[model samples]
Every structure is written in C-alpha cells, then in structure tokens.
Target: MLSKQLTTCLAVGVGILGLGFARSNVAVAQEKVTLVERFDAANPYRVELKVRLSGRLAVAFEKGKPPEVLPFSGSSTLVYDEKVLPADEPRTAKAIRVYRETEFARTIDGKEQKADIRPAVRRMVVLRSERGKKVPFSPDGPLTWSEIDLIRTDLFSLALVTGLLPAKPVSPGDKWNASPNAVGDLTDFDPIEEGGLVVEFLSVVTLNNKKYAKLQISGTVKGVTDDGPSRQQLSGTAYFDLEANRLTYLNLKGVHELLGPDGKTTGRVDGTFVMTRGPASRGDGLTPTDLQGIALSPTPENSLLLYDNPDFGVKFLHPRRWRVGTVQGKQLTIEESGGGGILLTAESNSTLPTPEQYLTESRAYLAKQKWTVNGSDQPRRISDTPDRVDRFAIDAEVDKQHVQMEYAVVAQAVGGATIAARLPWAEREELRKDVDRIIKSLQIIKRIEK
Candidate 1:
C-alpha cells in the first residue's frame, strides 16, 4: 500500500470519471468570487472517500531476497461523520468517528480479500483540536497509532483541501499564492523544488444544477523516505460546492518517482485517487442506507463491540459477548462465550512464508495429535489476506457421551493485517451467521512509520 497519509492526500483526492463541466450545454459564469471557507457548524460533514489504486509497487523486504513486485487494482471506501467547531483560532472536531463503517479490499496477484472494520473499532472517540495545528486530538485515551493517523489524515484532508480557497475575493482568471505551510503540510513541500504550488480561479460552472467554483490546483514535493528519495507532483481540477464550503468532487493525476543517489528516477507510481463527499451519518437519529442486503458487503448492524489498534493499523468488530485477550502483544484473540473465537495479528514484513506453506505444516502437527483433517480445500476469500480453511474432527467426552466435534482452522497473509479464525462445532449451528458477520467486518490500515 502507498504510505497512509500520502495515499489520502494524493490518491483519494483524484477524480476517476474524467468528466469535465466544459460541456457545450452549460455556460461558464465569469463573476467575482470570494471563496469564503466556512462549513455548517450545526451538521456533521459526512464524507465518503473512494480511492482506486492500480500499478506495480516495488516493495523491498529482506536483506538478500529481491523486492516483491505486486500488481493491484481496487477501490476502498471509508465513511466519516465529523463535525468541526466554529472557526475561532483553529478548527477542531466536536465529536468525530468513523460514521458508517470502514471497508477495504484488494486483489493481489489473483487473490482478493476484503473486510468491514466497524465491529472492532469504537466509533465514540472524542476529538479535540489544539491551537495553530489542524490535527485533532482525542481526549478519550487509548488511540492506536494508526487511528491517530487516520484521524489526522481526515482532519488534514479537510483543512488542506479547504485551504485552497483564496484569502481575498477575485474574478475568474485570477491566481493566488496558496499557503506554503498548508501545501508543505500535505505534500511535505521541498523548498528546493522549482515552481511553487498555486491555485487558479476557473470560471464557475453549473453541474447537476448546483453552482460550484471550479479550481485548478498544482503543486510539487520532492523528498526522501527511508526507502529512497521521491518526487511527487499533483495537478488537477476540483469542484468546490459554493454553498457547502467543501470539496464536492476532485480529479487529480499524481506521479511519484523513486530517485537514486544521483537524483534519477528508478521506479514510478502512476495512480488516481478519486473522492466523493456525501452526507454525514452522525447517529443523530439518521442512518445511511444500502441497496438490498449485500452479503460480504457493508450493511447495518446493531450495537456491538469495537477493538481499534492503530499502531498495527487494524480494527475490527465482534459481538459484545466475545472476550478480547492477547496471546502476544500484537497477536490478539477474541473468544466466544462458550466455544471458539478469532485470532488476529499484524505483520509488516511481506517476505514471510506463503499461506499454503504455513497451512501444510499446521495440518501435519494437528494430525499427530489424533485430529483427522476433513473436507476439500476450497476457494473462499477472507478479510485482507489470501486464506483457506479446513475442517478437522476431534473426539471428546461431553455429558459422559463420546462425540466428534468439528473445528475450522484458517491462516492467511497480506500486506496489512493477517487473520486466523476458527468456528467451533458447539456454536457452529447457533452462531453460524454471527461468525460470518464478525469476520466480514475486519478492517486494515497501513501503519505509519516514524
């Protein structure tokens, strides 16, 4: 995955459809515009972020092995309902959290897995902002490093995108110097880079009967990460809702080139991040709806439990009855009331063994313990990882009667979080649907490195 904040900044802000408002049917208005920046304080702004990532990314893992080259094309949706306090010194969130749910899926090589993250992540964290900076702080203790980054990206995106508005009113064809600080904050602006970022006031164009301020935004940031030096450039058009004071739609093309010691390009990233803003789902007695009951898709759920771990960049939802504990600091397990549960872990190293290799060794160990492996290995995609599950039978004495109980074992791998879950025979029939629901909602975000 692209770096967490960088993905949201460059990839999500892009527009995919490539439709321009310069159609022959609409007439562009050449009028003076103030571009005042203010959002409704009464209602929480609900934003639906959709990002498309495609192209080959070179990921270096081990000391001797060659970098793994992975090709991926997928869309991830994140819903946030955040209400910003009125502008005084610095804007902050009154009460902001993942509004509807967090969902992501990717197809690596030829395997695909996705999950919903609401069940494991609490949606009640309170965000408070400090002076001067737009980063939102959560007074409610215990925020995962990744969750903090998620909140920061969301907050930063709002501020960074809105800051495109010019401080003074001007007419069409006018240009202004965008705040260097805002631009630098989002893109890690490089002072040595030529041609600083600028904002142009394009003519207002009517779209779908709504008035908008069309803008042309361009910027470049050349810097270096631990992996290598990189140069990122962004140029595109954005449609800002005149009345709403928010970016309604945006389409930007980005180029990120990995540089060698001599400042020459070695690898390049070409992708578009198209985003759309929707109404907020603040649980203020209103809910967002889906078309039909889409299985393995995001749907409505009654109140449950939330386990958010940002440092590992994973969050999940399980039933309130499930007990959460840790086998290892990063390896977590959620146990059922009287039966089986799930095992979740996060790994950054992609050079680890494949899922098939791990499963084969696991089955051999279980066979020695008198457990007979049953069923054929079928293709069923699990959350985030390429995974497979097998059935096994173990004889046990229950109520003084000999019985054969079935258990499921799964092991999988991905770039973000890896999951291993089992469904126990005792609760298989009664909690079958619950088991499916719990696993379907696992969410993963790439952890941010210092």
Candidate 2:
C-alpha cells in the first residue's frame, strides 16, 4: 500500500452593448504546475458535494403512487483528513490516506432529506502515489467492508481516480483514464459488481487567469450479485488545477440502467454529482521519516517491483531478476529457468473472507486435491481487522510436475473480493527478500470484482 495519512469553479461571461468593450479574467488561461498531487496531513481540504436526479422514471404502476419521476437533489459538506504514510523502499513510493466525515444534507422535490449512510464505510483510504502509477490504497490499514465500498464509490473524491494521471504533462486534446479502475469496471458490457466511475482528460482551458483541465468522466457498476445495472455510461467535467496539483471541482452526469432478463431497461437512473473543495484548513506539514515511528522504509537492496492487475484488483511485486514463465488463468510462474522459481496464482470474487476462514477452506480444498500439507501456521495480521493475512505453510511437492516446494499461501482481505496468492516452494528463499513487499502490495483495486 502506498503510505497513508495525508492527503472547482465556474464563470460566465456576457458582452453587453456595442458601445463598450470589456476584458474578463474568465477569458485568461491558467498556467500548469510541477506538482499538483502533493498533500500534507495537517492541511485537510473540505468538499461541497451535490447530486441531482431528474427526467422520467420509467415504471409500471397499478394505482396512485404519484408521478414516478420525482425530481431529486442532495448536497453535503465533507472534510477529508489526509496524511501521507511513510515508506522506505526506493521502488515503492509513499501514498496518502484520507479519512472522510460527511456533514451531509440533501433535498428531493424541494423537500430536504437526511443524508444518512452506514458510518463504517466512512473510513480512511490511501490515495495512490502521485509520483508514479500505483493503485491507491483503500482503507490502508486493516481493510473494512464499508470502507471498501466507499473507496469503490469514491464518494466526494476529486475524481483523483487513485493516481491514474497522465504519464507526463498533458496539453489540450490529450486523454487519460478518468480513474485507474475505469478500464476494468467499464469494460465489455459486463455487470457492475461495485459502482465506480472514471475520468478521461479531454482538454485544458484557462478561465479567469486560472487553469482548468476539461475532462470526461465515464464508468460502469454492477452489484456484487450481478443484480445491478447491466450497463452503465457516464460523462463529466473536472476543473483540474495543473499548477496546484488539485481538482477544484467535478461535475459528473450519467445513467445506469438495470436490464430485464430480456436485456431491456427495467430500472434506470439518471443522475448528476458535483464535488467542490472549500478553503483548506492548514496544520503541521508532512512527517519526516525520522518521526515515522513504526512506519519505516523497506530495504531497497534488490527490491521487487509492484505488479498490479488493473481489472482483477490483485497485485504483487516479484524479484527484479525473475523471468515470466507459463501464464495460465490466474496462476503464473516467476522464475529463472528450470533451476528455482515461484509459481503463484490469484483470484478475486464477491464473497468476503476472514483470513482464518480462507485458510481453513483452502486447506480443505488442497487436501481434497490430494496435496499434503506438511505444516501450517495460524492466521496472523499485519494491519489488523479485515486486513488479516492467512498463511499456508508448505513442505511438500504438489504441482502437476511434482516439484518439491517450500512456499507459503498468503491471503489479505480486500473490498468486494478476496485475493488468494499462492507461492510454490522452489524460489521461496531465493526471492524471500521480496516477500513482504509482495504481500503488502496485495490489494483490490478501486474497481469492483464482477
């Protein structure tokens, strides 16, 4: 996980009588920045959130239930307690974690309603590193259920999309993923396992001497049971400050439709959401590594690189020297020829699992397959709670090739799905240095597992 802790506008112009000419700052273009993603723990930002639903709600009503298409609008103010977690690895960049609290309020048909949500999900999540492209951490500590949903929902987010930014400075007409999860969540017309959205960089414009990134937002969301929308299409604009490395405001509008078995629209929703940040409340800046306490740097010597699966919400970094071998299904081979290597496999699904539960079931499955477990260890935790780790201690040969192996099976609880990563015996010691790094990198991306 990238380390935690830390971390819009509009204008109108009108030309009046032909007798007078006037200049407006709204016409001036804004300048770009060197680092717009930086955020400190003390200076948290506030968000003014709003969502409105209009248009007709297609429904079949037998009697008097009033008009189905009742216009609805809701708004809220949220504060994000953001902090940067410290990391010691050269290859692994530290990331920002955000804790959100919503002072929510809304209205429907001119009637104000309470904005009540399960408090469990309103937890802290680690944003991706701005220095590089890495999946942002959701509930960076011990992952939680509601928190996972919050991350997937990206409620009141800057549409930061968990650090899915342009490879370099971008100009008008350049495009990038709205959010890192977009490529997966909104693909091939699949059911949305969890709701999420993505933004694409459309262009840049200057308004009132301020720079703004004109982008498009789109995505797909299917519920975990595959019972949600069969298809989702979205689009929006984000006023991004290139110089400030921040998103001033975001406006998204889209329609997610649930199709009947016949693939016809059964339940459809048309909505709009906007997030605008208020003036920042400053505090002490970043905590230097010396004061990091338990959070220290990872050894950089022969460090492994993080390999993230954009779609499956799985990631692990292998040793730098390992070569890719056989690639089948969710299993893979990280090796240096026939000598010594590690065979690993990972899969994601809808069910939630405690580390202990996963270990128990996995052991049973392996035994049913005739694989003998010479030994095993009790499940342990690194960050605690839903982020527990399950270990499958091994001392036997089990592969089709019957290769003698001594490895471990580790599992970490993530949102929407459980990722099971298996390690074969061969390269256990050879690449042991990368074990911690790989294990820590195991997480579900922002996309839902469908």
Candidate 3:
C-alpha cells in the first residue's frame, strides 16, 4: 500500500509540471515584436513600383435616363535606384531617385497613348512633406508634365510604408491606425476630411528562410485633388521583413471616385498596385561615385522643364507655370492656369519670312479681329541675327482692355515656325520672362516640308 501511494503521487506531480510547460510555450509564442524601418545612408535601395487602373469616365446619371460611362484604363511600371539621405532637421529623410525605366500607357474611349522615358533623362531629387513628395528638377532640366505624372502616381512612399508600422511592439491580432500623411499619400487626397487606414498585425510567416510580419490594411478617405473632390476605399497587405527591419513589400487595391464641384460623382476608377524594395544589387549602377558632382538640389534654371516635340522638330524649355495644352496638325498651344496663352504654328516654305514681313502679317491678322494697335507698330528685333529668328512683340487693345502679344518666327532651311503669345498688359513683365526663355532656348532640328 505504501508503494502504490508513492507511485500515484509522483504521477500527479509530473502531470502538473507538464501542464505548466505547455502554458509557458504558449506565452513565448505570443510575445510582441517591434517592426521598424532601418535605412542606412551608405546603402542604396532598388525600388520597383507597378500600377494598373481601369474604370469609367463621364459617369452620367439623370432621371429617366440610363447611366452613361466611357471605359478607361492605364498602367505604369517604374524602377528606381534610390538613395535615402538625411534631410532638414524636422523631416526624417529625402530620396534621390534615378529612374532606370519609366513606361506608361493609357487608354480612354478606345484611344491609347504610350510613352517610355529615355534612360538618360530619368532622374530627380525627391523631397517629402505631409502633403506629398516633391521632385525638384535637376540642374539639367525639369521633367515634362507627363513624366511628372508617372513619377508621382498614387503608390507607397517611404514614409507611408514606415507609418503603417505600429509605434509600439504589437502581438498577433493587434490593430492600429495609420498616420494622416500615409493615408493621404496612398489615397492621393490632400486635406483629408475623414477616415484613415486601419492596420492589423496578422502573423509572422517565413519566406526564403527569413521571418516576415504580415499586416492587413483597410480604410476609406475623402478629400480633393487639384482637379476636383475625390473619395477612395483602400485595402492592402504589407510585409515587414524581420531580419532586414524594413517594410519590403506591399500590395494594395482600391476604388477611386471623382466628384464634381456640386459633389456629384463624375468618374470612378478601380486600381491595384504592388511595390517592392530591396538593397541595390552589384550591377545596379547606383553607387555613390555615380552621384558625385551631380546637383542634388534645384535652381530656377534647372527647374525649367524641357519640352521636346520631335514631330515638329522643335525643342525648348519652359517654366512649371506653363503647361502644354494641345498639339494638333502643325500647331501647338501652351497655357498657364487661368493666365497667359501661347500658340505656335509651323509652316513649310521655300523661303523664310523676314522680321518686317512677319510683323506686317501679324498686325494684319489682329486688325481683322478688331484689335487696335495700342503701342509702337514697328517690329523690334529681339535677336541680332534676323536670318535665324525674327522675334518681336506688340501691344494691342480689344474688348476695351489692353493686351500684350509676342511673336517669334524661327527660320530654317526650307521651313519656319511662328510663336504667338497674348496676355494682360499689366502682367507682361512676369509672363514675358517665360516667353523669352523659350525663345532663347528654342532649337529647330528638322523641318517638315509641306
């Protein structure tokens, strides 16, 4: 009887100990972990961003009328060799991105346009803010409007990716909200009026023998773009590489709606994006030496954008305030937002027009439109070489308001180009500065013979 009692007691003690060991194991598995970004200035990163958006434009809904919509789709793939460096005291860092490839295409109503930026011209210095990232022009030249659009597409930013991580350690199933800047950048909404991204720590998974923390994100945002008011519903996943201590991969899909001035929905888009960032490889060519002697900041002259039109064989530089409006046939139009206007016409001829002859033609055309010549009618020679370019300006009156007009006739072997600009007389000095820059930099490579 004594032996039997001793055996039973030992068995019970062993069972209790086994239960305690199991409980301890569970606790260890549930421990929290801190996920943070570790960016070293000495190391460069290669980032690949790909996006595809498809939706409808001109969504019209009227009483007793079927909804009408036009199909639209666009895609862009961009690869960048980026270096994250320290920035101003308050801001964390800025990135100098050298774009290796930028390919974009868009189709609306069965019309498609595609462009691939040349390798030599793909570079910019990025400055981050709560609003968004700003790409200051290089000392060489500014990016064209279309190029800027592709570069600034709605995708993950370094700050946005970092902001999604919890400030404190988070265990599995823990949830938190992302910062406003992150939400705004992801949604392409400025001045976010409502809603934010909710992030949840899903679990840790192993990939390629490395542990990664998976996160789930979902949210809705309402705000405005420069065009109009907008709303977005975003849902995505991000992977935090525990070994690397960085957010290396992200995938997001969302629906975007554009609203009119009256708060009515005008358009809608369904889009998805995937971004991956990793250390630059050996042959990536983003070494510190490659960036040596390269200007990392923008000056006024370098900030000017290069506008190249191979069809007309005309190339020039213009400021950011000016935008290319339309190009049709042999004519091109550039306009400022609610301000000045410029028009250019290309004509093929056996002879180039003289400065005096061009001026006579310009005055005659304006006179036919009831514009009274307000100032001197003589064509003032802007360039000493009238044989190359006959450029001049005139002041006129129409609709009881003073108007200033500048004209340039670029002379070539067998063809010529004409530039005409009209703006308010009071704002001539500032607007003229932009026109003068274009005139000085304009180059005619080849002429289309009529």
Candidate 4:
C-alpha cells in the first residue's frame, strides 16, 4: 500500500583535519595542511541507493559497502503557487506548503560530527495560465494539460531527497527506471519541461561508521505539448548511506496530476519509505504473536487455516476449527455445512524439509488416508531449477464434500520456510495461472519491537 505518513531523513557531510608534532629536543621538519584543503580532497563521494517497497518504501544505500548507521536529523518545506489569469477578471493565485524532516551524524577525519540542517519555505514551482484573459479558466474543474505535465515531473525527481534542501541543479528528463514490469508503460515519462529541473542538498550524517548525503529537489513544467499550458511542483528527500552501500530512507510528496480547469488539483500521492541494507534474518524460534505483534484467530466461515510459520517451526493456522475429539488429538472435529466432520491429523517432527521432500511426504500421508488418487504426476518445476517444484494430487471424500486437490510446493529460502497451498479440484484448470500471483504476494513481516 502507498504510505500515508510521509517522514524520512537523509544527511551527508565530510570533515577533514591535519595535525603535526615536532620533536622536543632537536629541530624537526613538519608539513602544514589546512582543514579546508583536506575537506576539498574528499569533496565528491559517489552515492547509489535502491529503495524497495511492498507497503512502505525500504531505503537501501550503497556507498561501495554496507551502510553505517549514522546519527542525523533535519526538516524541510516546499511551497507551490498557482496563478490563473482571466482576460476580463483580475489575476488570482493559490499556494500550499509540503513539509519534511531529517537527522544524521557527519563523519570527518575518522571522527563523527553531529549536525541538524532544515530547509524551510523553498519555492518548488509556479504555474501560470495559458489562455490569459482570452479564455476564462474554471476554478473548480479538471486540471489543464500543463498541470498534469508539471505533476509528473515532480514525481520523477522527488526520489532524490537531497534535492529539496539547498536547491540543487537537475537536468530535464533525468530519469531512473524501476523494474520494467513494475513501472510498465510509465517508462520515459517526463513531468517537467526540458531544462526546468532543480535539486538541493539538505544535510550530511555519519552513522555506524558510515557517511550519508541528504538531498531535495523541485522543478517547473515547460509548455511542450499543444494540449495547453500548466504549472507543477515536485519535492522530496533521499538518504545515501556511504558506508552500507545502500539508500537508507526516502520521502516524496507532490501533486501527481492537475484536477480542475483552473488547474487547482485532481489527485495527489505522497509517501515515505525505509529499507534495510541486506537480507533479513531468519526468526526460527520466534512465535507468531512475537513476530506479527498479534495472535492468530479463526472465524466460523473460514475457521481453519494452515500456514508455514518459520519461527515456531510447527503450528496450525486455526486450531479452534479443529477440536481434539480422540486420544492423542489425532482425530479432529471440523465444523461442516451438514453439521460436523472428522479428520485425522499428523505433523512432521524433523526440521522443515525442502520443497521436494515436503510434497513427497504430504502425498504419501494422503495415500495412507485411503483417499482415491484420481490422477497423480509430477509437474514441471515452476522455477528455473529442476528441484524447486514438488507436485501431488488427491481425489477423495471428506464427509460429503468430494475433494480434488493438487499443489506445487516451493520453499522460500530467504524466509527459511517451505510453503504449500492446496488447489481445489474445481479450480485446477486455472491453478497455474493464479499460482504465481499468490506466490508473489507471500510476505514475511518482521516482528515489531516491544
């Protein structure tokens, strides 16, 4: 989901010092170097960061290595104004302000310096009416063509956080393409006119033995299309972690498109994102409640659920849906449409198996239940590797419900768990089509700290 809360900070700074000591007893030779000269030698540092998002943006910075945690903080604001000119009426304008904040530590000569820098009331963009007095602009209509172009430009550059601080220079159409499928047709799209872009550097910080650069940016839209003339605004900040080799944070806010005829506003999108630098750790011993911050509950309509919990190693999705009715809890009473149903339960005792082993055991277990196997065969591997997909099939009777099931089991290596979702017999025809979507949406959220 696009984040509603827009809070992010990026800071980058450098410090240099030179010291010389003379021998006490005899004449000594010493070289003198100024701090400014040392600082100038380290002036420009290369920075590259990638920010990923599932719900919120995860900022990962690359500075030739993993980023160091830097102490930092700051704030910034961007103001946008739109002026509408009517041939017969007086000129009128409206304005709005977008705010941001950042904080971090600065690194200098093997030492860290604490700093806070905030940029306030920076003008991002100014929109002007195209028709002037000749055409009457409606104050409450859809945005003009110019306005849409303006908003698009802002969205394109707002990912660079430092551009919003001190107003850095930006070339027109300087764009970074996300994944081709993710960004889709939006490739090569530009929001502002050529040569109208600007960027700002806000703050610098050092953390965890790493350095970071914070930046902010803005730009105006030039009349490129014949559709009409309009104005736009774009602003945001980015944190480049020099040590960790990743982008740690990024926040962007801007009018995506113009709404009304007077170019007031049609729609808007603003959000902030934070990302870790490397692969996430596996929490094998943690409980679901510990990791997810909430207990799992079952409902009557879909009471029973099954999931692979990497932390607990073994657990049921909805235990309440299956009540122990026999010795050793082998027999379970499940609520059914007719009244109730009985089913046997068993669990694996060894560490979670690979996808192949898990699927093989599940099939064998189903066979032991005496369920009729209408058809059984191994399916093609879903992944590029041959050992990734393990398939199984079962056609049987569970109470009155005639069940046909099949599944392709795959292990989430990074998540440190194996996952299996049963495919209903009726939906088997379309199972292959929908399976990828389900797999893509699977997530392992980190447990929140208490």
Candidate 5:
C-alpha cells in the first residue's frame, strides 16, 4: 500500500510540469505579433499636446564675472484637429490642421506672463514646407510671433508618428533602430549630425482597458536648429495601440542644450512632453462641412506671417523669412534671415510730422549713430487716406558695411509710428517685393490699454 501511494504522487507532479510548459509556449506566441503603421486618409484625428519645462538660464552681468543662474518655467497646451491628405509619397504627405485652442505661459522672477493670441489666425489652414520644416499659414492673415513659436518646433506630425514603428514583427525584448527622420522630428533636430535612438519592445500591457505595445527609447544626438547647434539626450516610452494600429501615446523627457560657436554649452533646457492622438470626438472642430472649400495649396500672400500688435497701435504682414525680435521701449525689431531687418518706434505726439520734416529728423538720428549717408532720396507720400504714410530711401555706410535703409512714418490723429528697414545693398532688389509687402500692409489701430 505504501509503494502505490508514492507512485501516484510522482505521476501528479509530472502532469503539473507539463501544463506549465504549455502555458509558457502560449505566452511566447502572443508576444510575437506583427506591428505595422496604417493610416486612413478618410479618418480625421484630434491631437492633444502638452509640454512643461523648468531650467536655469545662465546670465553674465559682468564680462569676467561668473554667470548668474536664473530659474524659469514655461508650459504650453495645444489642441488641434488634423486630417491626413493624400500624397505622392506616404512619408512626406502633408496634412490640413486647424487649431482649436492654444495656450502658452512663462514664469520668471516669480511672475507668470501668458501669451496674448488674436483670434483671426486660428482659422483653418494648410501647412506648407519651408526648408523641410512645416509652417502653418492661412489666406486670412499671417500668424503672430506667439502663434508661430508654438508650432515652430517640437510638433510631432503624422509622418513622424508612422516613422517610429518597426518595419518587421517585434517580440518582447526585441530591439531595433527607430527611424532617423522620426528621431530628428521628435527632437526638433534637422539633419541629425550623429547618434540615433534604439527602441526596445518592453512588453504588451493593458492601460485604460486597451492593450498597448510598450516601447523604450534612449539616445543622444547632436544637430543643427534654426536657433543654432543643439545637443539633446532623450529617454522616453511610446505606447502603440495594438487594436487601433496607431501610435496613440508618447511621453518624452529630455535635456536640450544649446551650443555656441566654440561648442560650449550656452544654455540647457530640461523638459517633458506628453502627447495623445486619436479619432476626433464630436465638436472637436474639423467636421466634413467645415473642411469644405479650404485651399490646400499655398499662395505667396497666404504664406506670409502676420504681426498684430494692438497695444502699440500697429500691425503688419511679413514673409516667412523674417522673424520678430526684441522690443525695447516703444521700438520693435523684425529681422530676416538674410541680414535684413526693420526697426519700428511709436510715439504719442499728436502733432504729426510732414514727409520732409520726418526725413530730416531720421537722417540726423542716423548720423548721430555714426552712419555716413552716401545718398538720400526725396520723401514721397505713399498714401493720404485714414493715415498719412511717407517714405524715403537712404544709402549709408555703417561699421564698414554698405546698407540700404528705408524710412517711413505713418501719422495718425492721436500718435504716429516711425519705420526703419535695413538690408544689404546687394540684396535690396532681391528682397524688394517682400519688403514692400510688409510696408504696404502696415496699419495703425486704437491703442488697447492692458
């Protein structure tokens, strides 16, 4: 009887071991599913992007003194409706995007300043490529500095999302190279100078009642940006929805360091971005009827960006090549990438100056700044309607560089604006049309008390 009981216990142990091996094989089979990126042009998606960053800026009060570090924090939230448009090449396809809401704020010295966005530029528009970068513009008008800045960098487009996936089936613990284009776009780095991201399939997990293929990515790359050379190190996870066949969620945190000419770090930005993409819900904007009649092609006028500054009682339209710069006192400066710029100053003098008087005063001011006026044109009245507009041109030499300067004054009943634009003499004719568009579109508005 004792020998028979021992045999039964051995048999039961063997049966339990066999069942455990069978279940392990089933789990391994479940992990080996193929992941492919599929997009449907008929479907429209709503994307919510949020970013928050806090870092210290190095400031040198004295030339030889050690730099002072100032703490600053900034956050931005943007919700937009996007529809993928058909393309000859799926990788470079453009999309129509309508921004429903955008909010940006910066905190410094214990004070927060929120961006003031106008409502007009928020309308429906097509995104056009400028030097391999996507820029959103509308037929209605140009976008302001705040609007353009928000969309300029760190925007993860459809092409980028599709590029992040593997070309073949990946199992748990499998690793592959995330596309270089995807990494560049994700980090706002164009033409990645060196290094790339390696993605490792972590596991399949359930989040919010949906299955997701969790992925881990880490790398460091050095690249060039519009601001200059930048180095960034990224560590993040991406959630690719298995059933939906889409990269629905991504959360990336990284340190972005700006390098100077000597390749030394001038500043560093540590930030995190969390983005989610999915089908649009009702009332998220981008209904079929709302998208009808929207122009997908960009015209020269529609591609231009608008600068609307109601506080200073002035607004104007400029080309994409020009970027708005620092504001000192009542003067605002806009600069073009090709060494051309405009300086505008507003004054509250009720007594408006005539074209001749304005020209004489401007030349005198330029002379005081050591500018040698080689030639000067007579002032002319360009418009005499709601506001009187007068303009004159000057050929001058300053700091051993020959430049062409255009001076204009828009006079109104309450106050007036003085405009000064400078560009390299050789490129004046090449940039003539763009400069004229800016000057012609200038308008004075009633000053809004903030």
Candidate 6:
C-alpha cells in the first residue's frame, strides 16, 4: 500500500513540472513589440472639438454638453506609415483612426449639466504637409479614449505629443521631426515648434527611479498672439515601458517668445509637458495623494533658512524690527540702523579648508573687485564651540565706507561645507555682534524618541 501511494505522488509532481514547461514555452513564443509598433498599430482618429466659451459666444445645443474635468482627459491620434495609407487615396482608404473623449461641467439656461462625450470613429484626410514631399498618412480618424484623456489632462495636445517621442543621445546636425506640421520657417520661438520643430538628443538620465533619454529641439513659430514670429525651444526626457510595450513617460519643458500687435516678438510664455501610460493596477489613476500642498511663506520673526532640496537645512531668528529683502541667490535680508545691511547666503565648498586657508582663497577672490582689506583679527568661537573665527576690515574706496566683518567659519571632517551669512561693509561691526550672538545660540534639536 505504501509503495502504491508513493508512485501516485511522483506522477502528480511530474505532471506539474511538464505543465510549467509548456507555459514557459508559450510565453517565450509571444513576440516582443516595440513602442513604435504599438503606437502605429493602434487605431488613429480625430474630432471636431468645440468647447463652450462662457462670458462670450451664444448658447446653442450644437455646442453639446460641457465635458467633465476628469483627471487624465484628453485627445490623441496615432501616426501610421504613409506607405500603407497614402493621402491621395479615396476617403474610405485614406481614413485615419483616432481616440478622443471630453468631460466637462456646463451651465445651460441656469441648469448645470455634466457630460462625457466620446467619438465612435471619425475620418479625415491630410490636406497639407509642411514638407513638399508625397503626403504620408491622413490626419483623419476616430478618437481613442487614451487620446481624449491626454488632451483634457494636458493643457496642449501638440506640445504633449512632441514631448512623448524618443530622445536617445544623438550627435549634432542630426535632423528630427518635432511636430505634426513640420515644414514652416521656425527660428525664434519657444520649446515647441513655431513653424518647423527639430530636436537632437543630448543626454540620458535616470530619474524617479526610471531611465530616460533627453533631447534638445528648436524652431520658430507664431508668438502667443496672432502677431509676429518667435523662436521656441524644447528640452527634456522621454522613455518607453518594456512591460506595457508603450511610450511611458515624456517630460518636456521650455519657453517661447510672445508676440505683440505690431508683428514683433514681445516677452515669453513658458510651458511644460508630462505624458505617461494610463493606470494599470486597480485604484491606480490620479488620486488625492497626487496633489501637492501649497508652500507657506515664512513669518517675519521666523525667516526661511533653506529651501533647496538634496541638502536642505534652515535656521530662523527674531528679526528685532529689521527690514528684510532678498540678496542675489540667497534669502534672509536685513537692514541695520547703522546704515549697514546683512546678507545671509548658503555657500558650498568642494573641500572644507581651514579658516585661514578659506579666508585666503576668499580674500583673493574679493580682492579682484578692488575692495581693500584694512585689518584682520580673531573673534570668539560660536556654535559647537567652533575651532576658529576670523575678523576683517573692508574699506570701500569707491562707495566710501568703513566695514568690519566677522566669519565664524566651522570646520567639518567632510569634504564639503557651507557658510550662512554675508554682510555689507558699512555696518559690519554692529551686524557682526548680532550674528555672533545668533550663532552662539544655535542648538541642534533632536526629535523626541518614540
């Protein structure tokens, strides 16, 4: 009886192994699809999109119900090889596929209505191409759900699509298509194509724990208004998802010139594009967690010490009724009664040189500005009982002022360090005394243990 049972168990184990092998073979046989293939094969289309413009224009039923402002709503169309579908063909053969949807809230006749509209299929033929070559694919088709979602979520569709393309590193002088309409004279404009957009890949980066290829594209286009022309630039990252077999993320950012009524370039309008694959797992779309909190301004008594990330740290103090303003790249500005100003900045050094060595290098750099150093001395140590302190007299011949400054520079074993305060020459002595006190009061606070 024991031998029979053992034989049965062995048979079951062997059957399970055989089934696993068959499944693995089937998975291997499935052909791998690239991003381009998936996009091209997907049906392409377009829609006669018309949104109701409140505060202007008349109310009409043809305007249709307003679309819901759902997260990830927009419109998009896939591009197919021209060889398969020529533009000169009949409407049936030349028809292109498109995916589109719109969700919005609208008030009609004092009644608020919410609507979601999607195109079953729409066809359009390519009327014109920027390049005077044989027209490739027609711009006509039914809209897809993905395309409409993107259009609604992204402020601009063309800009978002251009950003989604591959941007692997490429040498200079390489020609690349930067827009759907790629044949106009684009010179001075923004990141998106003004008339004709061409981009060249520059580098690659791994961000948000994902790898991305970067590119730099430039061209000229019409200014923000229907006035003149301006140059535009596009630079950012793009990548493909191996698992989804689609273009996953495209992050493009840049600026373009705004034009005036005289047909001349004016100021500029900056823009950004971020495109990603739709949600995969359950409860994975945009959620409340996606929204970021607004940054609160620092109070008068408590100044914001540091805001830069990666090495962020801050310190604040009672202003004692001092005027505050920004200076250069640093914050925490103060004006003293003695006709002097204090500028607090974070200075980063590659190496933590000794106090004397740091001052020697710093003074040399400062001397280039022709500011004379009248005298020097050592002051009392502050915070952590620093090992060294240096005081110097800066005489401004041009501005005609006598300034005394003190540096409570501390040394750390690490290679890099930062200095927090920079004071003006005229009121150095008085500000120096307060700075010394502030530094001495520095105490490293530790979070209470759980």
Steric clashes per prediction: 13, 26, 0, 78, 1, 49
Residue 103 shift from truth in candidate 4, angstroms:
24
- TM-score per model over all chains: 0.52, 0.41, 0.81, 0.23, 0.77, 0.27
State which candidate has the highest TM-score: 3
For candidate 3, write residues 11-69 as lDDT tens digits. Answer: 32233223322332222227889998866668767677778999997644677664567
All candidates' lDDT scores?
A: 0.53, 0.46, 0.73, 0.31, 0.72, 0.36
Worst ten in a row by lDDT for model 6:
132-141
Predicted structure with the largest lDDT when compared to the true one: 3
Q: Judged by lDDT relative to the true structure, which candidate is superior, 2 or 3?
A: 3
Those runs of model 6 whose alpha carbons end farther than 4 Å from true positions after fitting are 1-86, 89-100, 103-233, 241-246, 254-256, 261-270, 277-450
- Give the Cα error of residue 406 in candidate 2, in Å: 35
Candidate 5 error regions (>4 Å): 1-32, 59-66, 86-93, 123-132, 206-211, 222-232, 253-271, 283-288, 349-351, 361-378, 394-405, 423-425, 446-450
lDDT of 2 by residue, 1-450 (tens): 111111124331111111222344223223432224555444455544555554333343556553244444444444554444544444333444333455445555567766433343233333333332333232213332222333433442332433445546665455554443333422223323555554455545554455556555666655422343356667666666655566666566777565655667665557766665533443222234423443223334323344555654455555545554666665666564435565665544344465667677767876898887666666555555455444444444465533333234343444433333344455555445455555555565544333
Residue 416, model 6: lDDT of 23
Residue 323 alpha-carbon offset, candidate 3, angstroms: 1.4
Query: How big is the positional error of residue 69 in model 4, measured in Å on the Cα after superposition?
Result: 47
Greater-TM-score candidate between 4 and 5? 5
Q: RMSD per prediction, one decimal? A: 15.9, 14.6, 11.3, 23.9, 10.7, 26.1
Candidate 6 yields a Cα-based lDDT of: 0.36
Displacement of the residue 362 alpha carbon in candidate 3, Å: 3.2
Ranking of all candidate structures by their TM-score, best first: 3, 5, 1, 2, 6, 4
lDDT of 6 by residue, 281-400 (tens): 221111223212311112322221211112322333323434445544423455655555555433333334556665676567558877667755543344333423333333333255
Model 2 ranges with Cα > 4 A deviation: 1-48, 54-77, 86-152, 155-164, 176-208, 216-227, 282-450
